[model samples]
Target: MFVRIVKMSFHQDKIPVFLEHFHSVKEQIRNYPGNNFLEVYQDKSNPGIIFTYSVWNDETDLENYRHSDLFKEVWTFTKTLFNDKPEAWSVDKLVTLG
Candidate 1:
């Protein structure tokens, strides 16, 4: 599987708004072909710092989603709330215990 991680920092006051938007669209994103899993995480001490973790069947699937209309609408709303440029990385699983 291909794992993708995107670290996003949002203005503190915008967390709720961001969460609302995410909730509105998460199901559609999760339904994309080759999508294995999807989730968002916030820093324990810094709630405004969030990370989006997702797993895909491969890079092609990941790219396909990125180019989809779903991404355009989602990202358009999402980018307006970003406090910083988000960071993203694609990686391969190295180990799984259990």
Candidate 2:
């Protein structure tokens, strides 16, 4: 499995808008081909900072999604709300404990 994490910092006033947009599209994103899971998180110390954690079948699957129209639509609106450039990481899971 492939894991992706993205960190974004938004203007304080835009947080609610972003959350509303996210809630509306999260299901579509999660159901996209090759996507295994999706989640969003907010920073404890900084409410404007958000993170998205997702699982993909592989890098190809992720790349495909990145190039898709859905991505373009989501990113277009999302980037407008950002206070800082987003950061992302793609990684392999080392281990998980139950």
Candidate 3:
């Protein structure tokens, strides 16, 4: 499996708007092709910082989703509220726990 992590920092007041938008389409993203799991994390010390952690079946699957309409729509809204450059990376799972 391949994992994708995206870290984004948003304007404090925009957090609610962003979360509302995410909640609107979270289910569709979860069910996208080859998607295995998805989760959003927030920094306890800095609530404005958010992270998207997801598992995909492979690189191709991830690429497919990135090129799809879902990404376009979701990202369009997401980018507008970002206070900092969102950092993203792909990785392999080296260890796991519940």
Candidate 4:
């Protein structure tokens, strides 16, 4: 399994725009091929900082999604709202608990 995390910081006023865009695409992202899970988190002290956590079956699956048109569309909209460059990490899971 592959785990991906992305941290995005938006302009304070652009947060709502980001959220609206996220709401529109969240389902498409979750339903995309080989995706296993998706979650969104917000920083406790910084409302404009957000994180996306997702799991994919493998790197190829993740790449496929990255290359998809949906990603292009979403990312184009997303990057415009950023206050700072986004950061992302992809890794193999070390452990899990719930």
Whole-model Cα lDDT of every candidate shown, in order:
0.94, 0.96, 0.97, 0.95
Compute the lDDT of residue 58 as modeled in candidate 3. Answer: 95
Instruction: Encode model 1's per-residue lDDT on 1-88: one tens digit a residue.
Output: 9999999999999999999999999999999999999999999998989999999999999999999999999999998998999999
Better of 1 and 4 by lDDT: 4
Rank by lDDT, highest first.
3, 2, 4, 1
Write down the TM-score for model 2.
0.98
1-98 per-residue lDDT for model 2 (tens digits): 99999999999999999999999999999999999999999999999999999999999999999999999999999999999999999999889899
For model 1, the stretches where C-alpha displacement exceeds 4 angstroms are: none
Q: Give the clash count for each candidate.
A: 0, 0, 0, 0
The numbered model that scores best in lDDT is: 3
Give the lowest summed-lDDT range of ten residues in model 3.
Answer: 89-98
Per-residue C-alpha lDDT of model 3 across residues 1-98, encoded as one tens digit per residue: 89999999999999999999999999999999999999999999999999999999999999999999999999999999999999999999888888
How well does candidate 4 score on lDDT at residue 28?
A: 98
Worst 10 residues of 2 by lDDT: 88-97
lDDT of 1 at 83: 90
lDDT of 1: 0.94
lDDT of 2 at 65: 95
Model 4 lDDT, residue 49, Cα:
94
- What is the Å distance of residue 52 in model 1 from its true position? 0.5
Tell me how far the alpha carbon of residue 61 in candidate 4 is from the true structure, in angstroms, after superposition. 0.5
